[model samples]
Target: MACVLEAPLRMSVLSEVTASSRHYVDRLFDLDPQKVLQGVIDMKNAVIGNNKQKANLIVLGAVPRLLYLLQQETSSTELRTECAVVLGSLAMGTENNVKSLLDCHIIPALLQGLLSPDLKFIEACLRCLRTIFISPVTPEDLLYTDGTVISHLMALLSRSPYTQEYICQIFSHCCKGPDHQTILFNHGAVQNIAHLLVSTSYKVRMQALKCFSVLAFENPQVSMTLVNVSVDGELLPQIFVKMLQRDKPIEMQLTSAKCLILTTLPCLVRMCSKDRLLEERVEGAETLAYLIETDVELQRMASITDHLIVMLADYFKYPSSVSAITDIKRLDHDLKHAHELRQAAFKLYASLGANDEDIRKKPILESGAIELLCSLTQSENLALRVNGIWALMNMAFQAEQKIKSDILRGLSTEQLFQLLSDSDVNVLMKTLGLLRNLLSTRPHIDHIMSTHGKQIMQAVTLILEGEHNIEVKEQTLCILANIADGTTAKELIMTNDDILQKIKYYMSHSNAKLQLAAMFCISNLIWNEEEGKKPSLLMHRQVTILIKKLLLNSNICSAQCIGIQSVMGNIILGVVWIVGVVRRHEEDAESSLGETQGHSDNKQELERHRGGFHL
Candidate 1:
C-alpha cells in the first residue's frame, strides 16, 4: 500500500488502462465475447470506486473502445451490457472528461445500444446515457438535431421502474433551455412526467417533479401547460401547491416553488390590485414583485399582464427610514412593510427594464421609480441602497441621451460619486456599471465628463489601486474605455499618467478579458479617425516596448494581435508602420525608445503571457 501511494499517479493507474496501448481499449474487437465481457467487468471494478480512476482510464483512451463494444451488432448481450456499465463509469468525471467521451458520439451509441431483448442491456444503456446527459455542458442541442432522439427517449419512459427513473433524470438534465422545453412539451413529455408525480417510488416522484422545474425554467408556456395538466383527478399545479405545505418533504416544497412560478403569478398580481387597505395592498405587491424580480422573462410577462407593472408602481411610495418615520413605535409594522414593499418594487423595476429599452426609459422613468431609486441610493439600509442603485443602473442601460441626463440628474452628481466608493463592493460595482451605461453615447458622455471629469478619474483610480477583485477592476477599466471613447473626455484621461500606467499594466494581465479591456481603453484614448491622434512621446515610448515584447513572445492569438496593431499604429506610425503610430514623430521617437529600448525592456518586463488566448 505504501509503495502504491509513492508511485506516480499516471503510472499507477490500473493495469487494465496502461498494460498496452490497445489492451483493454481494443478488447472490443476480440473474437471471444466472453473474454470481452470479462475484460469490461474488470475495468469497471477498477474504475468504480474513485473519480480519478475513471478520469485516468478515459485519458488512457478507454471510452472509444468501450463505446465501440456497446455499438457492435455481433457482440453478445452480456458483453454489450458490461460495456455500457464500464462506459457509464468512465462518463462520471469533470465536464472536460464527459466532453471528451461525447466527442466520440456516446449519446447516439447508447441510444441505439438500447435496442435489445435483454432487460439488463437496456438498463445499462439507460444508466450510461443518463450519466452522459447529466453533464451541465452536454450538447443538448445534439439530442434534438437528430430528430428521432426525443421520440426514442420517450419510448423508454414506461419501460420499467429502472428505465422510468433514469429516463426522467435524463430528461431533467436535457430539458435545459427554452428550445428543449418547447420540443419536449410538443412531444407529450408533460403527461408522462406528470404521471410520475403519483409514482409509488419516491425517487421517481422526485425526479419527475425536478424535471418539471427544468422544463418550466424561463419558458412560460411549459409552466402554464403544467398548470393545466390533470394528474389523478388533481390539476398538476394543484398537486404541486399541496406539496408546498409544511407536511410535504423540504425537497418537494422547493421543487414546487420552482415549477409553480408562473401559476402563482396571476393570483399574486390580482392580490395586489384588489380594493384592499393600503397595508394589505403593499404586502401583496411585495410578494408578487419579489417573485419575478430575478427573472427577466417573468418580469416582462408580469408587466404586460393584468396591469402588473402599473400596480407594482403604485406601491413605490419612497422609503420608510428613521428620517421620514416621525413615530417609530407607533408605525412599526406599517413602515416596515412599506420599506419591504419599496425594495421589492425597486427589484421589479430593475427586472422590468432589464431588457426592454422603452420600458426602462419610459414607464419606469415616468412613474418616478427613478426618483425613488435615487433617494434610496443613500439610505442607511444596505439592501435598500443596493437595490435602488441596481434599479437605476438597469434604467440607464441603452437609454437615450435625454434619459441618461435625467437618470444622472435624478441620481445627482454628489450621490453618484459617493456610491462609487461605497463600502459594500456590490454597491460599488453596480454604481460602476451604471456609470458605464450612462456613458453610452458620445454626446452625453462628453457633456457629463466635461462637468465631472476629474472626480470620475479619481474614483476610478482609487478603485483600481485598491484590493478589489479582477471583476471590479475589469469594470473600472470599462468605465475608462467609455470615457476615452469621447473626444472631449479623452483629453482628461490622457492627462492622467496614473490612469495610463494602470491601463498599460493591465494590458499584460494574466486574465485575457482584463487584457482586452485595458487594450481597448488605450486604443480608444489614442485613436482619432478624423484628426488621427497619436500617443505622446513619453507614453509612446512605454506602450511600444510592451507591444514589441508581446510580439516576441507570440502569447496572444491572431485576433488579439490584429486588434492591438491598430492601437500601435496610432501611437507610432500612421499607415506605413506596425501600430497606429503617427508618421511625423516616427524618426524622432524611433531614435528615442520605440527601437532603442526594445532590448533592455524585453528582459525587464514581467512574465505576463500565460498561454494562447482564452478570451
Candidate 2:
C-alpha cells in the first residue's frame, strides 16, 4: 500500500516541476532578471534529463526567451549562464528541440557569450554550443566557412581543463570535412590538442582523442600529422595503443581502435606509385592534389617523400608524349590517356607549388618541367590551359628575376597575349594573375616589363577597355601599379593616355580596393622615395586634382593605408618643394607670403588635410 502511494507522489512532484519550469520561463521578461532565474535553474535541472518534458517546455516557448536573456541580460552574468545551461539541456532533447534552438541565431549569440570575461558564463555557453554541434541538425560546415572560428576557440584551449574538453568536442563535431581539417590543423590544433592527451582529466584526454579521430578520419595527411605530433613526451600513436593495451574500459578501447585504424596515408602513397597504370595514376594525382592543396605543412611533408615532386612532374614527359607512341591501333587510346595524365599532372603542379616555392620549383626547374607546362598552356583543352597557366602563376610567385624572365620567355609574348584574349574569363583571370606574380617585386617588374612591355600593356588595355568584370579591371590596375614601381617604368606608365584615363576612371571606382589600387599607381608614378621628390609630376592636371579630391573623401581601410600615406606625402612634397623654391628665389621685401603657395583651392585643400597627416 505504501509502495503504491510512492508512484502517485512522484507523479505529483514531476507535475509541479513542469509547471514551475513554464512559470519561470514566462517570468523571464521581468524587470529584474535575477528574481526568476534561480527557479528557472532548479526547474531546468529537474526537467533536463527528461527528453519528453524538454520537448514539452520548448513547445511552451522556453528556448527563445532564454536566448534573449543570454543576449540582453548583460548586467547579470548568472542569468545568462543559467539560460545557456538550460539551452544546452534543450539542445540535447530531440531533433525538433535542437532545430528550434538553432533557428534563432543561437550559435552566433553563444559565440559572443563565450567571449565574456566570466569564466563560468563561457563554460556554460561552450557546453551549450557543444550540445548544438553534436546534433545532426546543426552541421558544422554549414555554420563555419573558414578556420577563423577554430582559431578563436583554440585560443581558449588552455583556460581550464573543462574548456579544453568542450573545445575538443566542438572540434570533433565541427571538423567533419577536408576544409575543416586543414583549417583546424593550421590553427595549431595538433599541438594544442596533443597536450590534452596527457591531461590528468579523463574527459579531456578522451575528447582530445575523439577530435583527432574526426580530424584524421579518411584524411591521410592529417592522420599522418596526428600520429607524428608529440604530446607531453608521448606520441599520439603510443597513447592510442596504450589505451587499447592498458586497463582502460571496453568502450574506450573500442573508440581507440576506431580512431587509430585510419588507412588513408598508406593507401594514398600506394595509389600514387609509378606503375604503368594511367587511370590509377590520374586518380592518385587528383586525390593528392586535393589533400595538399591548402596545407603548406602537408605539401612540405609530401615533397620529402622519395622525390615525389620529380615523379609527379615526369607524368608530363613520359605518359603524355604522344609522339613516343608508334603503334597505330593504340594511338587513340594513348592520346586519350595522355590528356588525362597531363591534366591531372598540371592540377598537381598548381597545388604542389601553391604555398611553397622550393618544393615544386626546384624539382620542376631541374627536370625542365617549365617548358612542358608552357606548351600545355597553349593546348586547345580548356581545363589543360587553366591548370597549366595556374601552375605557371605559382612558379612565378615571389620568384627571382631570372625565373620570372624564364616563365615569360617560355610562354612567349604572343602566346601570353593570346591567353589574355582567350574567350574564357577564367583563363584570362589566371593570365592576369600570372602577370601579377611575374611583376610582383621591383627587379621582377623591371626585367619582365623591359622585354615584354609593349605586348603586356596591350593586354592590359584590352582587358581594361573590354567587356570584362570588375575583378579583371582591378587586377589590370594592380598590373599598372606594378609597372609604375619600375625604376624607369613610371615614366612609361604616365605616357600612356589610355591607361591614364582608365586609372582616372578607377580612382572613383565603387570598390574601395580598386580605387586604392589606382591610387597605388598614382602614388608610385608621382612619389619618389629614394630621390625625395616627385619623379613624374607629369600626371595630367585633371588626374592630380581627382586624386586630391578623392583623398579627402576616401574611406580606405588600414590594409591600403600605405597607399594613402604615399599619395599624401607626394602631394605635400610638391607643395613644400614649390614653397622652398619661392622662399629661396625671393630677392626683395616686395614678395608677399602668398607667393610661396600653389592655387588657392589646392592650398586650402592641402591645409585642410595637412593637419591629419603626421609625416
Candidate 3:
C-alpha cells in the first residue's frame, strides 16, 4: 500500500489509463466496465504522488468509473479520497451526475477521506462533500433512513478547517428547500456556522455569514430563533462592532452586508407583530430597509433572498438550538454602507412583493398597509394600480380588521364604488380580480355589501349595459356570475325592459367577440325562466333582431352560428310568450267585439320581413 501510494507513476501511464476508462464508458460499451474500473483505481493509487496531474486525470476522465466503483466496494481510506477527487471533478464538470450518488454509508467514507493524511486527497474530499451536501432534493425522511447525512456532515465540518466555507456552500444549495434546511439547523449547524464569522479566512467568514443569512431570511422560525440567538440575546451587534474595526475582505464585507439584510427582513415581519423581538424587529427592519434602499439592487437581490432561503431549508432539516444571545450598541450610527447598492436593492425589493406569495396581506387594510395600498389605487401606471389593488385585496383577506377602515377611508362608498367605472380595461379587470379575492373572505363580502355593494352593482350594471370594450364587458359578466346569489343585477339584466334592448344591440354587433360575450351575458341572466312576470314585447324584439341577422349572414362561422343559435333559443322562448299574449288579445277581442286578429299582424311578421327564414 505504501509503495503504491509512494510510487511516482509516469504522466503518460496515468493519461493512457484514464483515457482507456473514458473510452470504455463513452464508446467501448463492449468492454468489461469492471476491468476499466480496476485499471482506473490502480492508476489513481500509482499517480497519487503527483498532485497536480494526478488529481486532474482522476477528476476529468475516471469519475464515472469511480462512481461505479463506489457502489461495488467498501472503499478504503486512500480509495475513498481518490474517489472523492473524482466526485468533486464530476461536480465541477459539464456532466452533473454526482447528485445521484447519494449513499447511506458515503458520509463515513467522506469523513475518513477528510481525515486522510494526503493533502490533495483531503482537499478533494472536502470539495466533494461541499458538492454532495448541496443537493436540493429533501433527502427523504432519514429518521429510519439517511439521518446520518447531516450527522456525518456536522462531524466533518466540526473537524475540517474549512468548516465554515463548506457549511455555507451546503446551506447555499439547501436554500432551495426550506423544509430540508430547517433540519440542518436543528443539528447545530447554526451556531457552528456563526462561529465562522470570526474565522481567520475572510472567505470562510463570508461564506458563514451568507449561510446564516439564508437561514435567517427564508424560514421565519429560524429567523425568529436567530433573532433570539443573535439580536435579542446580543450576539450579532458585537460581531458587527468587531467587523467594523477589522480590515475585512471585500467578499467578507459583502457577505456581512447580505447577512445583515437577511436577518432584518424576517425580523421586521416579527417586529410588526409586537413580540419580544419588537426592538430587534424594529432595528432589523430599519437596518435592512436602509440596506435595500442604499445598496446596489443587483447585488442585494442576487444574494439576500437566495441565502435566506438556503439557511431556512437547512434549519428545517435540523432544529437544534444553542443558548440565545442578543447584542446592541444603542446608537443609530447606521453604516452608510453601499449607497448605490441600497437604492437598487430597495427598488427591487418593492418590486418583488408583487411576485412573492408569502406577503399575503389584503389589498386594503382596516388602518395600515392595506390603506396605504388603497391610497395608491389611483396611480397613473396601470401596472401599479393593478398591483396596488391586488395587494389591498390580499391584505383585506389576510387582515380584515386591519384593512377594513383603510379601504373605507380611502374611497367613499360612491367614489370607491365609482372605481368600478374606470375606463381602463386593465383597471376594471384588476378590480374584478380584487373583488374575486375579497369575496372569498366572509367579512370582506359583508363589508362590501354593507359599504359599497349597491354602488358597485350600479357601476357593473352600466358596464354590462353599454361598455364597448369586449374584454371589459366579458369580465363584467363574469363578476356578476360570481356574485349572482345575492344580487338584483341578474333579475334586472334578465327582465328589465331597457337592459334587454342593450343586450340585443350587443348581439347584433359586427364584432363576433361582442356577440359571443353578449350571448354569454344574456344566457347567465336567463338562468331559470323567471321572466314570466314581465311582458314579452322587448324580449321578442331582441329575438327578432338576432334571428333575422343569423338567417341573412351566410359568411358567419360556427362560433357565430352557435351564438346565434343560443340567441335563437332565448328568442324562441320570448316568441312563445309573445304568441301567448297575441293569442290572448285575439281571444279577448273575439269575445268582447266579435272580431278575430289577423295572422299578418303577428310579431313573426316583423321577423320574416327582416329575413329570418334560414337556420
**How high is the lDDT of residue 458 in model 1?**
85
Q: Could you tell which candidate, 1 or 3, scores higher by lDDT?
A: 1
On lDDT, the candidate that comes out on top is 2
Query: Candidate order by lDDT, highest to lowest?
Result: 2, 1, 3
TM-score, predicted candidate 2 vs. hidden true structure: 0.51
C-alpha-based local distance difference test score of model 2 = 0.72
lDDT of 1 by residue, 443-507 (tens): 87898898778778888998989898889998988888888778678777767767777877887
TM for every model, in the order presented, reads: 0.48, 0.51, 0.43
Q: How high is the lDDT of residue 304 in model 2?
A: 56
Residue-level lDDT of model 3, residues 556-608, one tens digit each, is 33554565664555444444544544455555744422221333244344334
The C-alpha stretches of model 1 lying farther than 4 A from their native spots are 1-30, 50-61, 94-96, 117-119, 247-249, 266-298, 304-615
Better model by TM-score, 1 or 2? 2
Candidate 2 residue lDDT tens string, 494-569: 6777788888788767676677677777656654444323335423554455455554555543355566555555
**Model 2 regions more than 4 Å off:** 1-270, 318-331, 510-513, 538-542, 548-615
Better of 1 and 2 by lDDT: 2
